[model samples]
Target: MTQTHTHTHTHESHPAIIKRLRRAGGHLNSTIDMVVQGRNCLDIAQQLQAVEKAIQQAKKALIQEHLDHCLEDLVGPLGAGQRKAMDEFREITRYL
Candidate 1:
């Protein structure tokens, strides 16, 4: 069975993050095309690596932004009981 967990941060992704993701998406598409065309293995690997790095960077930026803005605002005045849960969440995000 698959369980879904929900996050409370509903804010839109930062523009830079969006751009980064979109670029990564485009690169991913190009990588697919390259594979289909039987491009050199080394060239395909390089493109795939670029796509992977781009996506990783976008994810990192989004997570950082969430911690910077959403969590900062929410946690600032959280009650002691509430903060414990948020602190747990904060710790979890670090692994992402």
Candidate 2:
């Protein structure tokens, strides 16, 4: 069996993160309304794209804050496993 490691951090940007998610939720609702109203295809696509970007931005902000503040709590230099995890996180975030 493989052991799982967990790290905990006090999220200082929690409120800001919630605000961003709420904004994205609002954007999603607007997009839904546009679809229901039979809006133009181009307009609907643009709104969807906007919502996607907003969500990506929020994810980026949250990840950055985690790295900047939360990760700092680790004592001394990062070990191999930690470094690998960080690398994997960076790679996954490239889609944003």
Candidate 3:
């Protein structure tokens, strides 16, 4: 994708992204409270893990959405070689 890809305006911003992040923040706060309240170590670990997973989900959704919208728009008409590269690139992004 071109450098201008970041500037492309989609129909809506990352609403799901925001929601996941907010939920993660709430979990983090709860985790902190749990720590202060002498909760069981295993329970605290589980709460922290929940926070980590929520943040990770938000990150993955953001990357996939960017690829789906911005990259697809910028690479409007790909040639044979470019098409192969694009497809391979998409495959690699699955790691995100």
Candidate 4:
């Protein structure tokens, strides 16, 4: 007897996303440096907040791009399947 399996995957990758993530990484490294240098708590908190927001924005952009490029393309016209997939995506977004 023989068995076969298949897997399909698409990566959500964009240059802008990469740039934003790199910026966030740099900000995080700076935040660590600030901690080492004993910066003010408020200053550290503000930098951390900025880093968090940058990461959040990057995530938002990546998801939106996936929806636009992959999901929207896959679902195409306004049909039952399309509507169901869109609804499922909307429900999933509640976590964000």
User: Model 1 clash pairs?
Assistant: none
Span of ten consecutive residues with least summed lDDT in model 4: 4-13
Report the Cα lDDT for candidate 2. 0.80
For residues 1-96, write the lDDT of model 4, one tens digit per residue. Answer: 898548655555677888899999999999999999999999999999989988997898778777767776675666897778877886686468
lDDT of 1 at 26: 95
Q: Report the C-alpha lDDT of model 3 over 1-96, residue by residue, as the tens digit.
A: 655434545435488789999999999999999999999999999999999999998887877777767777776977899878877887787686
lDDT of 2 by residue, 6-90 (tens): 9554577877778888888988999999999999989989988888877887788888776755665555567899878877887
TM-score of each: 0.67, 0.65, 0.74, 0.67
Q: Which stretches of candidate 1 lie over 4 Å from their true place?
A: 1-13, 77-96
Query: Which candidate wins on TM-score?
Result: 3
What is each predicted model's overall lDDT from 0 to 1?
0.82, 0.80, 0.84, 0.83
- Name every residue pair that clashes in candidate 4: none
Model 2 stretches astray by more than 4 angstroms: 1-10, 75-96
Badly placed stretches (over 4 Å) of model 3 are 1-13
lDDT over C-alpha atoms for residue 35 of model 4: 100
C-alpha root-mean-square deviation, candidate 1: 4.9
Candidate 4: where are CA atoms >4 Å away?
1-13, 80-95
